[model samples]
Every structure is written in C-alpha cells, then in structure tokens.
Target chain A: MKFTINRSKFIKYLTDVQRAISSRTTIPVLTGVKITIDKDGLMLSGSDSDISIEIYIPVADESNQLEVIEEGGIVLPAKIFNEIVRKMSDETITIEVGENLQTSITSAKAAFNINSIDVESYPNFPVIDSNEVITLPTTLFKQVIQHTVIATSTQESRPILTGVNITIENGQLKAVATDSHRLSQRIIPIEVPESLKENSYKIIIPGKSLIELSKIVENQDTIEMMVTQNQVLFRAENLYFYSRLLEGYYPDTNRLIPANDSTKLTINANDLLQATDRASLLSHEGKNNVIKLTLTDDHVELSGNSPEIGTVEEALNYIEATGDPLVISFNPDYLKDALRTFGHQNVVIGFTAPIRPFTVVPADDNSDIAQSFIQLITPVRTY
Target chain B: MKFTINRSKFIKYLTDVQRAISSRTTIPVLTGVKITIDKDGLMLSGSDSDISIEIYIPVADESNQLEVIEEGGIVLPAKIFNEIVRKMSDETITIEVGENLQTSITSAKAAFNINSIDVESYPNFPVIDSNEVITLPTTLFKQVIQHTVIATSTQESRPILTGVNITIENGQLKAVATDSHRLSQRIIPIEVPESLKENSYKIIIPGKSLIELSKIVENQDTIEMMVTQNQVLFRAENLYFYSRLLEGYYPDTNRLIPANDSTKLTINANDLLQATDRASLLSHEGKNNVIKLTLTDDHVELSGNSPEIGTVEEALNYIEATGDPLVISFNPDYLKDALRTFGHQNVVIGFTAPIRPFTVVPADDNSDIAQSFIQLITPVRTY
Candidate 1:
C-alpha cells in the first residue's frame, strides 16, 4: 500500500491487531499482517486460526496524519514489519508497493524493501448481522471476564470447558467458568431493548480470546458485540476482534454449588491469601498439592507438609467463627485463586463438610456488586 | 542455630549470596544455602560448582539488624528459604533449629518448620594467602568485564574460549575475551603496592562468574581479588565471591587485531549502530546473516538482502572517510556488538583489506581511557 502516516499512530494500530497474530500458526500466510489502503483509510488485520483482529485508520482522522498517495493492498511479514516500524526514528513513514510485489518502507534516512504476500490469499471475515448487535459498557465487560476467565480449563480434551460461558437472561448478564476443581461466576445488570427482552442468548467464548480482547479494548468506553452461529465479533471504536465459538454445550454447574453450610468463618482476604501462600511452600508437586485448614474455637491453623521437604504452619485469629470445629484439605492454589477473585476486603467461607466443596463469598454482601459474585472450590480428600 | 535478625537486612544478605545458587546443579548440597549462625552473626553461602558466593552479616555492622542467641550452623534449601524470608511480614524473623535437623522459622503470627541438610557435607572453601591481595575500584572492575564478557564463546567445545583472560602486570590490568569470530579487550592502569610490585599474575575467570560478581559488587567502592592456583576469590566489604579458574592457556589474540589500515571510517557510534540494526532486519538466519557496507569518498551505505525476503538500504553521512572506496560484507550482529561496546560517543573503525579483521576504536582517542579499549571483528567473504 502506498501511504504516509504518523509513525506512532501506525504503531498503535499495528499493536492492536498484532494481538491475534501467532508466529507458530500452521498456515504460512497467517503469520503476516494484511494491510489495505483504499478510499476509506488503511486497514490492518491479523489472524491466527482461532482469532482475527482488524484495526482501521481513517484518512479523515486528522490526528493520525495519514495521507493516501495511491490505493493498493499488501500482506507484510508481521515480525520484520513490526521491528522496522518500531526502530524508525522519523515522525512520518511512507510505504509504496513497487514491481514484483516488493514494498519499500521509507522513514528519514532508512529504507526497507520487504517481500509482501498476496492479499487475495488472506482469509475472509465471517458474515454477521450488524443490526442484532448487543452493546455493553467496557468496564463491566472487562471485570466479569477477568474474574471468571482464570477458572477456565486449559486442557483441550473438553473444548467447551476451555471457554467462559456468558449468558444473558432477564436483563442480567452472567459469566461462569470452571475447571471441575474450582469455579468462578460473576453477574452484571445490563439494559437491553424490549424487542430482545424475551430472547435469551448464551455463548461460550474461549478464555484465551477474552484475555487478548481485554488488552485491545482498554481505552474504549463501550463495545458492540455481534454473535453468529460459529463466530463472535467485539467491535470497539476503530478495532474489531473476532473469536470462534466452541460448538459443544457447557456443563450445568448450578447444582454443583452447595446451598447450605454447617460451618462458616469470616476473615480478612489478604490474611487468608498470605497464610495459604506460605502453606503452599511445602506442598509437593505431582501429589495432591494439598494444604489443610483447621478451624477451632479461638483460631484457625493452616499447614502444608511434604514427605521429602518439611512442613509449614501458620495460625491466624479469625474475625468470627461459628458451627462445629472442622479440619479440611484442598489444593492451596485453588483457594488462593478464589480469594484473589474476590475484590471485597473481608471474605466469608462456608463449609458443608470436610470432604465436600466449599464456598467463598464477601462477608459484607450489602453492596449490589458483591451480592452477585461467588467462587467455589472442591476440597481434596486427605485420607 | 537460633537467631532473630531484621528481616529486610537478612533478605539483602540472602539475595547477594543466592546469586551463586543454581537449581540445575548436579551436587545436591550446591542447591542449598549453607547458613551459619554464631557469635559473629549469620553467614549465608551458596555454590553452583562453577562459582560460590558467601555473604556475612556481622552483629556490629550498623543497620544490619542482626542478633545471635546461640551458635550453630545448618544448610537450608535456597528457593524455599528465600521465599519464606521474603513473604514474612514481621520486622524481625527468628530461626531456631530443633532436634533431627528440623528448623522452626517464626515471624510474627506465622511459623514455618522446614527440613535442613547437615552442614558437614557442604564443600569447604579453597585455601588462599590472606596477606597477598589485589584491590581496585569496583567501577573499573565492572567496566572492564562488561566490555569484554560479551565476546566470550557460548559453545562448550573449547572450554578455554568461554573465559575472560585477565592479566595484571606493570601496574596495569588487562582483560580480553574472544569467541574466534570477534574479540574485545580493555585495560586500566592502577597503583600496586611495592610489596607486590614484583609479582605478575594471569588468570582466566569464567565469563558467567564475572557477570554474577559484577552484580554483587555494584554498591561497593573497592573490591579485593585473591587468585590462587585454581580459584579466584572476589571479596567485597562483607561478601566473598569465589570463582573456579579455567585451566589451559588462552589463545594469543593480540596478533589478530590489525595495527595499520588502508581505509578508515569515523562515524557517530549511535548512527552506525542503528544502521547495522536496520540492515540486520533483512539478513536471514542460517544464510550468513550478512550485511554489506559500501564506503565512498562522501557517504556510506549499508544494505542487506535475502532471496526469499527483500532488501534494506540505509545511507548515512560520515564524519570522515579516507583511503579507497570499498565494498565489504560481514555479519551485522558482530559489527553491532563492536560499536555498542565502545564507551566513546563517536567510533573510528580501522580497516586493512576487505578480508582482514577490522579494529573499532574511539574516534577521539586523546584520553588515556580511550587508548586502552579495543574491539575487533572478523569479516565474512561475500564472494
């Protein structure tokens, strides 16, 4: 493409689209960033097999300092192009496609002529119904995804479990993720038009895609999402992020959470997190990676022991304790993750039995946000 | 051993000594830090076969924040102990050894009881003459090492090429390292006491050990060096860094550098560095990684090309160009290294024939410091 644009602006657009580019892609052309310059502006698109991103720089945007001298398209090697743009010291950089698919990039005293792939070989974008797009605040979207995405399974054996299942029903958006050992879920009250009130929607988005989407949409206020049968697109101001949807159904996890509890303990989140972290120091790998928690009348003891290494014990005074005194063992990493997901200052942990799963919720549930979030961890049987 | 020391001060000592510890050591005890608590204070030492570092915290040192309750010694696992000490919130941490090599680490409300190895199995320090030592400013020591260490061979085929050969004679300390493709040398003048004037010494210190020692001696003003038959110890105020010397004679690299030149180019160090970097973008790996430099009577041009990829060309105005116009090709990485190692603002490159190695020196070599540092890089035959 023949064009001249502000160097920093071009870099910003390149970085946004580069989030979806993978150097290890099986498709050779997927390693390039497709650049197109036409009547509208310059569009930079990058894709792995799983996700694709496109960021557009409109010619009318004065701050971008873009001027189109010729209309063309080219796919440049992602890594070399990125390096050249970053290392160029000039304020403005010019790119022109010459004979034999050779592209020359000139900036001040430096000029780079790199091979460009045919744009026709690039994959086409999936079709979507733009009229049925759903809009949500960027902040709420980022928060819900961050809290639940971490709990998703990393194994690809069960593809559905590797995604965060997002559902919209009764004017509320809920996101849940679980890897069987632990589960995290968050709900946000959203406003939808009356025409879509009776229609419920659920989509399982790959956790990995959500992480990349979060980084690209940081500066935007709202995002428009268009979901089709197989792919979902999240549109920001000048960026479009598309991810493939998992085909299988997500497991019904509502029945897994215990409804009643016999023992409860309220403690500071930081204190419990620290104690578990220290206890995990001695927990051996390839084993259960378990740490025990003993709740007594006056205090709680957290300890971890390894046959090869030694043991660690930490006792802390709880804010309040009730029900029968109990001892339980579980993977300390899961407990740490649960505590970290809770933004509240105090956490109230509920236990049904030593062998059963436990629930961690905010001690002060008066706030609307805290009332809608919950994290559950399944304990490991020490015996 | 039983002692309560200021947690932060203890952490500092542990960090310094921990640099010598490696998780991949074949010797089991080398992975553990030997901690000795006595009337003097606490001593922490770690070794990875190639190098060992010992840091002592004396009870009398100001702000060391140490107290000795009993006298004993034990070896603790480096990773676990470092983590426990770092995570403790208490200002003072008390460590007490119990029966059967069990250690109780108590800090505020937390206590960690960990396994400790028997101290008797740890390797003993090498014997050296305490009276005979060479001292130099830590800054000078750091500078000479940094300038030459990068040139050391990373391959294990020839073990001697991996070490930096340091020689002291005629009140001057000279350091040189080469990987056969490129070589770097630096010298610094110093005053030696009359008692040691007659003694001249040459030792090859492993480049990796010099890198670690440089980090530990950053805050110290002066360092004392003790060279024995097979080991060299770098001693700071309260720290001892011992590195095993590389045996066998070093190659005679003094004759490789050209003393006269038919062509010379004087250019800004940054300009040359940037041009070579851009040129390298198009230089393909495994295919020579070559970049060509064309020197004319007026301007210099740098260009690189790959058959599959394209080409890059950068032209820069030089301060001075003399002799005949020439076209030469060399690996850009080696040239970039030579220019980057020079501390001078501007670099003067001396060239003989296109096939001979070139010398990169400071353009303004009036100062004593500039005259002592020289770097040489071999050129690849382009034909």
Candidate 2:
C-alpha cells in the first residue's frame, strides 16, 4: 500500500502485532505481516494460527501523521521489514507498492525494495459472531491472569492443562489453572447481565495468549471481551487480540485442594521466598531438586542437601507457627513461583500432612468471597 | 581458615577472580577459587590455564571489614561459592574451614556446609622473573586495546592472528591486530624507562585477555605491565592479572598498507557507521555478506543486494568525495566495526583500486606520530 507515517509511532503498533507472528510457523504466509491502507486508516495484522493480533492507526490521530496515497494492501516479510523500519535513518517513512508485487520502503536517503505477497493470499481472521460484549476492568483481569497462569502446564503432554479455565457466574469471574503438581485460583467481582447469570460461561484459554494480551493492553482502562464457540476476542481502543479456545474439557480440580489443615505457618511471602531460593541453590546441583521445611512448636527451619555439593540450612523467621509439628519436602521452584505472586504481603501456608498438598493464601485476605486467590503445591515424598 | 567480611565488598573481589575460572576447564581444581587467609589479609585466586587473576583484600582496607581468625588456605567451588555469597541474607558473611575439609559459610541465620579441596592441590601461579615494570596510562592503554581488538581473528586457523602484536620503544607503544581480511593498528605515547630505551620489546597478548583486563582496570589511574619470557602480568593496586603469551611469530602487516591513494571519501565516522549498519542488514541475510560503495567526484553511495530477499541503496552524506571515481565491495560488518572505533570524528577513506585494500584514517589527525591510528579493509572482488 502507498502510505507514509511517523516512523516511531508506527513501530509501536508494529511491535504489538508482531507478538502474534512466529518465525517457526508452518504456514509461510503467516510469517508475513499483512498491511492494509485505506482512505480512513492503516491496519496491520499478524497471526501464528493459535493467536492473531490486529492494530489500527486511524487518520484522525494527528500524531500518527498517516497519509494514504493510494488504497491498497500487501504482506511483507515481518522479520526483515521490522529490522528495516528500526534502522531507517529518518523520522518518517514512506511505503509504496510497485509493479510485479515489489514494494519500495524509503526514509530519508535510504530506500529498500523487497518482495511482497498478495494480501488476498492471507487467511481471513475468524469471524466472532457473538455481539454480546463482556467489559472487564483491565487491572483486575490482569491480576487474575498473573495469579493463576503460573500454575498452567507448559508441557503439551496434557494439552488441556496448558489453558486456564475461566468461569463467570452470578457476579464473580473465577480463573483456575493446575498442572497436577501445583494449582492456582483467583476470583474477582464483575457485572454479569441477568440473561447470562443463570447460564454460567466457561472457557479454557491458553495461558500464553493471556500473557501477550496483558502486555499489549497495558495503558487501557478496560477491555471488551467477546466469545464464540471456538474463538475469543479481546478488544481495546484500536487493538484486537483473538485466540483459539481449547476444545477438550478441563479436569475438575476442586477436590484436589485440602479442606482442613493440621499445621499452619504465617510468614512474609518475600522472606520465605528468599530462604527457599538460597536452599534450592544446592538442591538444584543435586539429583532431586527438593528442599525440606521443618516446622516445630517453637521454631521453623528450611534445609537442602546434595551428595556432591553438601548441605544448606536456614532458620527461617516466621510470624507464627501453630497446630501439630510437621515436616514437608517439595520442589522449591513451585513455592518460589507462588510466593512471588503475593509480593510483600504475609501469606498463611496450610499443611494437611507431610505428603498431601499444602495451600498458600494471603494472610490478610478477609474478603466476602472466601478461599479466593489460593495457590496449592503437592509436596514431594522425600522418605 | 576463617574470615568475616562485608558481603558486598567480598562479592566484588570474588566476581573479578571468577572471570578467570571456567567450568569447562579440564583441571577440576581450576574450577574452584583458591582462598588463602594470612595474618596480613585474604587472597582470592582463579585460573583457567590461559589466564589467571588474583585479588587481595587487605585488612587495612576498612571497607572490606576482613577479620582473619586463622592462617590457612582452601579451594572452594567458584560458581556455587559466588552464588551462596550473593544470596546470603546479611550485611556480613563469615567463612570458616571446619573439620574434615568441610567449610561452613554463615550469614545471618543461613548456614551452608560445602566441600573444599586442599589448597596444595591447586596449581601455583607462574612467577614473573623480570623486576622491570612498564607503567602505562590506564585510559590511553584501554583505548589502544579497544581500537585494535575488534580486528583480531576469532578463528583459530591462524593462532598468531588471535593476539595483538604490541611493541614498545622510544616512549611509544604500538598495538596491531588483523584477521587477514581486515587490520587495525593503534599507537599511544608511554613513558619508557631509560634502561629499556636501547631494546624494543615485542609481545603477542591474546585479545580475549586484554578485553577482560580492560573491564577490571576501569577505576585505576595507571596499570603496571611486567613481561617475562612466556607470560605477561598486569598489576593494579589490589589486582594481579596474568595471561599466557602466544608462542608464534606474527606476520609483518606493514607491507600490506597502501602508501598512495587514487580515490578518497571523507565523512563523519558515526554517519558512515549508521549507514553501514543499515546496509549490512540485507547483506547478512545473503550468502556473500558484502556491500558495495561507489565514490565519485560529487556523490558517494552504498548498496546491498540479496538474490532471494531484495536490495537496499543509500546515498551517503559526505563532506567530500573527490579523486578518481571508483566502486568497491567489501563486508559491511568489518567497516561498521572499524568505524565505531572512530566515534564522532570525521574520517578520510583512502582507496588505491577496486581490488586493493583501502585504509580509513581520522581526517583531523595531524599528530607528528604520522599514522597513529588506521583501519584497513580488503575489498571483495565482486563482478
């Protein structure tokens, strides 16, 4: 397409769309970014099959300085075109399509002529037929994603575990993810229409897609979400992010969390995180990568040992330790990840037994919605 | 052995010594850092056979807060020890050698018991028999190293070309390095001892070693260099850096520089560097990885082409383009690397022929040292 725009402002939109483009995509045309310019504005689209992103630069925004010389469209190689734009030695760049599907990109005295694929060859974006839009506070939604996504399985052995199960019912939206060994759940209040209150909506979205969506929607106040049978769309002011939904049913994880505890330890999340990190250093050099935590009536201690590297022990500082004395061993990396989500807040860790899964929840979380924002980790059997 | 010191201050010394320690070394003991606590102070040493570093933390330096309880020595695993010290949860850390060659490292309530090797098993550092020390200004010497090291051959086909040939005589030190295709030479004035004026000393120091030395010697005003038959020692206030010399004869590169020129182009070094970076982007994607420069009486242009990708052309902004009209092709990466050394200064490029090597020299250079700094690049014979 024949168009010129501010180089820096255009780069910002290009980077957002590029998140959906992967160099390793099997579809060759998917590796290219589709650029369409009309009398109104310019739209850039990128997709890697599972996720697609589209950003529009409207002509009404004077800062963009967008001028459409001709109404046309073309798809250029994303990787090289991005490099060319970044390295161009000018404040503004002009891109024009020429004969034989050759495109000329010029900025200052530098000009590059690269091959282009016809825009018609690009696959059409999935049509999100549902007109019902669910508007959610960006900050609360981001927090829910950040809290639960960590427990999502990165391995593809169980593909359904790779996605976070999100359910909206009555006035609350709940997000849960579990990789069998660890689980995280967070619930937040939302405005649910009366028509959909009876029919709860449940969708499993890939955790990877949510991360990209979170990053690109940073400055926006709210995001509008629309769902179809097989696809979901998150729309901001001028940005649209679409992700494919996993087809299989998510496993029921409610029974996995313990209802009662025999022992409890209250400590600052960051303090415990640091001790676990130090203890794990030696364990990481060993075969099992596990650390032990011993809680007594009067003291609490963490220790790790490696036959080749030696041993590390730390008398942890805790606010309180109560109930029956207990000793537990687990992969410290799981606890570290869960603790990070709590930041500087004090967390109460509940243990049912030495072998059963333990739960960590904010100590000061006295909310109306009980058991919200809880992380559970299955302890390793050291004995 | 036992000593307690400020954690941050001790970590600084440990990091410097760890630079010389590589986990991939054949000698297992070399992977450990040798720590010797004497009545005077603590000495930390690490070596990878090719390079050795020893940093002394004296008791007189109050910032170290080093208190030696006993006089003994041991070698602790470098990587794990450094990590433990960094993650220790206290302002000060105490390291003590307990019974059975087991060392106890304690900070706050955290304790680590790690296995240690006998100090006698660690190889001793080489002794430099020469008493004569050559002092060089740190800033100027660092500049000389930076200007020439980029041209040093990374390939081991010609082992001698991997080291910079440094010669000192008549109150001047000259350093030169080449990868055969490109060469960089830099000379700086130094105060030569009266006794050493009669004889010129030539030594080939590995470029890799010089890069490390430069990074560690930043705050020092001057560095004392002592050369022996097969080793070179660079000593600062509390640091001693030793590097093995390359045992080979360096090829004479003076004859390769052209004495006369038929075409010349003068431009700001930074301006040309940016243009070269842009041009190289396309060439890097191609097979030959070469870009062409055309210099005429009025204009200078740079262009690069990739058969599968496309082509890029930029009319370079120059202060002067005079002499015979010419077109030359060469690897833009080499030119970019050489141009970066000149920074913001204007440079005059001299060319004798399209196939012959061309030289780039600072345009404002009128020093009596004649060619104090110069970069030469051999052009590719592109038809």
Candidate 3:
C-alpha cells in the first residue's frame, strides 16, 4: 500500500486513536496502532484491554491532501510513530508498505524505514451485535461523564466499584459513582427506548473508558450509543469508540441517600469553595483529610487542624440557614470536587446532624425546583 | 515583637528565602526560618548545608511604618510558615511574638499559633568582608552565569569541575566552565580595585551557587558584588545575598582550544538546533547519546539510529560552507546546551577533522567583529 496524507489530519486522528493504546498492556499487539488505507479513506485503530478508538481521515482537497494507489493494512508501534510524525517538517507524509512488512515513511528532508508487526497478530475486536441503541447529544454525554467519573474508585480491590453505575428509569438516565466514602449522581432526561421498558439494567462502565469517550465526543453534535450484550459502542461522525462492560452487579445506592434533612444552607459557590480549599490545606496532612463545618445564624465557619502544623478558620457567607446549629466532619476533597462541577452561582447544602450523610445541591441550577440533584458525602468520626 | 507588612512584599521575600529551606535537613533548627523583629524591620532567614538565603520584609512607607514596642526574635518552621502566609486571605497578616516565643499570625478570617524555637539556636551567618568588589547590571550578571554554568559537570567525581571558573584580569571579569568534553567561556569588562591588578586568580565558584543567584536577580539595575576569602555577597538595593565559594583552583582551559581552523561552516542556529533535537529523540535512548554530522558538497546531513527503534536522516541547510567534507560524532545534548547559550540566528562552526575538536560561534553575535567568541567541543571516536 502506498499513500500520501496531510500531516495535520493524520496527526489529529493518530492522537485521537492513541488514547486507547497502553504501553503496558499484557497483550503486546495492543501497543501497536493499526493503519488501513483503501478507496474511501485511511482508518487508524488503537486499543488497550478496556477501550478501543478508531479514527478515519477522508481525502480532502482544500490543502494538504492524500492519494491512495493500493488498499492494504499494517500495525505500527504507536509510541515511535507518533514522535516521528510530530517532529517531521514536511506538510505531507508518504507511507508505503513493502515486503517483510517494511514500512517506509518519508517527509521533506527526512525518511524512516520502520519494521512493523503483522496486522493479523493484533487481537480481533469482538463484533458488537446491537438490539438496543440510543442517541444523545455529545455535550450532555460529556457533562455526565465529567460530573460523576471523579467519584469512581481507583482501587480495583472491589472490581465493581471501579466502574460508574449508569441506570435509565422512567424516561431519565442517571449516572452514579461511589468510592464508599463519597457518591456523585447526575440525572438527565432522555427519550426512553421501548426495549428497555422491562427493568433498569445496571450498566457499569469502566471509568477509563468513559474518560476516553468524553475526549472524543467533546465538540461533536451527536453520538450514537449501541449497547450489545457485553460491549457498548459510541459512534460519532467518523470515529468509533468501543468499551467492554464490567461483569458484576452494582450495589443499590438508593437506600444510602436520606429522604430529607433538618437544617439547610444556601451559599455562594465560589465563597464556599474558597473556604473549604483554605481549610483543606491544614487538614491534608492529617490521616483522614477531614475538615469541620459549623453552621450558625447566617454564616458557616470551616476549620481544620494538624497537631504539629496548627489550625486555620474561614468564615463563609451563606444565603440562609435554619434549625439547630450543626457541626459535621467529612473529607473536604469530596466537597472540592463537587464545587468544581457547579456552573451556577450558589449551592444549597442540607444536613441531618453529624452522623447521617449530607447532601450539596445547586440552588437554582434545576429547571424544575422539585427535582434537584444531590451529592452525598459520608461523615468521618473525628475523635 | 510585632509588625504588619504588605502581603505581596512578604510573599515575595518568603519565596526567595524558601530556596534554601529543605524539608529533610538533619539539623531541626536549620529546617526553620529565623525571624528577628527590631527597630529596623523584620528579617527572615533560611539555610541548608549547601546554601543560605536571607530576605528582609521592611515596613513599607515613605519612612518606616514598623512600630517596634520591644525587640525580640524567634525561629519558626519555614515550610509551614510559608504555606500559611501564602494561603491567608487577608491583604496584610498581623504577626506577633508571645512571651513563650510562640508566634501568632492573624489574617482576615484565619489565625495560626505556630510554635517557634529560640532565635539564639539559629546558626550565625558569616561576617561580610570585601577584598575586591565590582558592580554590574543584574541582567549582565544573569547573562554571565547562563553562558558559562551549563557546561559545568554534574558528576561530583571531580569536585572542581562542578564549579564555574571566575577570574578577573586587567579590569575585565571572565567566566569559564567545562567537564573536559565541552567548554564555555564568556568575558566582560568590569572595574576592579587598584590592589587587585597584579595577576588573575582562577577561583572556582560552585556552579549551583551561581544558578541560585541568577534566579534571584531579575532586572537591569546595578548589583554590587563583593568577593571575600570564602564567600561572595551580592547587594541589590535593600536586598543582600551571600553565598559560600568553593575551595579549589580551576584548570587553565586556554591551550585546549585550536587557534584557527581551515574548514568552517556558518549555518542557521534554529535549523541546527531543530536537527540536533530531532536526532536526540532517538540517540537519547542509546549509550553516550551520540549523533553524527556529515558535511559534504555544501550540504550537512544529521543522522542517528537505534538498532531496535530504526534510523532517521535529514539534510540541514547551510548559510556558508568552507568546511572539509567529513563525518564526526559527539554527544547531541552538549551541542544542544551550547546552542542555547550561544543565542544567535546563525553560527559559524570551525572544524579541524572528524576526530579532532571543533568551535562554534555566532555569525552576527560576536563579542568583537574580528575576534569571535568560540565554544569548543571535543569529538567522540565512533567506529
């Protein structure tokens, strides 16, 4: 196969596909990116064990263009191929495959002959059979991943907790993730498919796969999600992302959330975030990284202490506060993460004493006031 | 003792003094910054075994706004104090020393009760003595250090090579540094004392100290430098900096350089740097990090290869070529460093042969039109 492609176009697709290629994969061939040139365009594919990304570069006529004389395929080492394409000065790079899988890439003043592995050596990706499919706006999908993915457990000891729990019920798609210490839940309304009307299937998707899909769907208009028995395929315009679903039952988290709270606070988002951030500096060195929040008349005082490093106190202005004054201790890092997801000006935090889990919600971020989302953080006993 | 200083001024001074404060110092007192409050102002000092830094945050007003009710001093842990001062929300933090030597620093909504050690426990700084002193713009001092310090050896096997050789001869101050493989020499005229006109003293100043001073001095204002028996003091406005000098005579590097060469090539500096940087991408993984340069028929080819990772070749543009057609190999990293220091659009490289040493100088950035400042690099024999 011999073809000349625009350097920038090839570079963009190469980088997009490289997101899934892991250098430390147990499957050695996963480290190589598969490149195929045909009459339509050039397709590049890369995958780790968990996720796969494929990007297509169609021949365009505006500027630097590509021409294909033959149809063939080869797998090149992603790490070295990326560095060469990024550093070459030529506007266009010509790639040709010869005998013994010898791949020659030539630019303006530079030429490289790289030995490539046989494309057949790569593991054949499972063909996704689809009975259920749903379409969602790319922006909304990316937002769902961003809001809940940070809450997933990084430790794989309880393999089930490493994935985000996605559930669709009563015309709403809710994404929930928890590391046993804190939980984030994001709810969005979508046209429910008639096939999923029986019961909500607890689909647990690996956090890493969602992160890669978020990057690829960032500025796209729409994305088509095809759900098979064991795999999920997210197809955007010319790029296809596939991730294997985790095989386990997600825990029922609905019982952990409290139905109501005794005292509540509406506070400016930035002020609360700044106060918690300052208090975190003193608590980060401690064993649990816990910071205490004390609420009174119209303000909340955030305080934290390290036996050797001293203590810090910050007064946060609140929109309103009621009921008995309450004090609770929890991981300030969880609150910091929740604060970053807020695009609105104010947030309302609800508490039921120190023992029960508390929730933080956007004050006016909800279209329907009765349907407000909440982030529940478990309190740590600071004795 | 008590005083309130401007937030920006205190933060700036704290950042400068923090360079010498290491977290793992053996001496517990050395890990702390000493604060002395007297009628003059507040002095903050930090030190490790290798270097010491002292910065004074004087009262900012037309005169002195520092009201000293009593004179007192204390040493507080530098790392914790700096973090507290940096994270405080108040524009000006009020600091006061208690009867028990405990320090209380209060900002808008925050207060810290930091424990402190007695100031008498802190090590005494060396007395300032000037045998010879000269003054130059801060920019010139930084330029001098940058030009000569990069070639200093990092390996401590030969301790003297780890320092930059500084000598003053006939109203001129010159700096030179090398690790036997590459050498950098820079000279500029400076006024010397009448008593120091006998001969040049080739004293090796530790390269690490020069790098520290370069970071502190940031402008074109004149800074007075005084050289004592074992210390160098740089005074810039109200700031006084002191650094310890190395105790060794530097080697004479004059005879190692060739007087002139029959073959020379003037090429664009940017083009040469890019070629070397690209070649380094592969050579860096190889032993000795070597790249070969072949000049033939007015064209230069920069090439490198790793047996397992393939090879790369590129034709480099030459502005002028009178060099003998030959191939030579050397550490690409040393050439990269020399290129950074010798900042010119085009540079003329004079070569004796493939196995012999060579010199590189700016095409237009000559210290003198007739006598160009030359950097010499010894060639490596590659079979």
Highest lDDT against the true fold, candidate: 2
What digit string (tens of lDDT, one per residue) describes model 3 on residues B246-348? 8876788888788878688888877788778878877875666899998887678899877666677888877888846888999888888888776556888
Q: Residue pairs in steric clash, candidate 2?
A: none
lDDT of candidate 2 over A1-383, digit per residue (tens): 69999999989988999999999999999999999989999999999999999999999999999999999999999999999999998999999999999999999999999989999999999988775778789998999999999999999999999999999888888999999999999989888666666767799999999999988886678888899998999999999999999889899988998999999999999999999999999999999999999998899999999999889999999999999999999999999999999999999999999999999999999888977889999999987
Report backbone clashes per prediction: 0, 0, 0
DockQ of 1: 0.81
The candidate with the higher TM-score, 1 or 3, is 1
Where is the poorest 10-residue window by lDDT in model 3 chain A?
A365-374
Local accuracy of candidate 1 as per-residue lDDT tens digits, B1-383 = 89889999888888888899998999888889998878977788898878888888889985877888899999998988999999888899999989999988999788888888999999998877767789888998898888999899999999999999999988899999999999999989877889999989999999999999988885677889988889998888888899999999899988887878899998888888988888887786337799989898877899998877788888885788898888888998988888887644788888898888988887877756534888888999989
- The lDDT of each candidate is 0.87, 0.94, 0.80
Q: Which tens-of-lDDT digit does each residue in A1-383 have in candidate 3?
A: 88898899788878889999999998878999999878878889999968988887776544538788778899998998988888878789988888878888888877777778888787777687776667777898798899888889999898888899997767677888998988888888777568766645458899989988888765777788887778888888878899999988889888888888899988887778777887887788666699999987666788888777667777776778877788899889999888887755688888887988888888877455233366778898877
Please report the candidate that would top TM-score against the real structure: 2
Candidate 3 DockQ vs. native: 0.59
Q: Rank the candidates by TM-score, best first.
A: 2, 1, 3
lDDT of 1 at B42: 78
- Residue B91 accuracy (lDDT) in model 3: 72
Instruction: Name model 1 segments beyond 4 Å from true.
Output: A367-371, B369-371
Instruction: Provide the RMSD of all predictions against the true structure, rounded to 1 decimal.
Output: 1.7, 0.9, 2.6
Clash count for candidate 2 is 0
DockQ-best of 1 and 2:
2
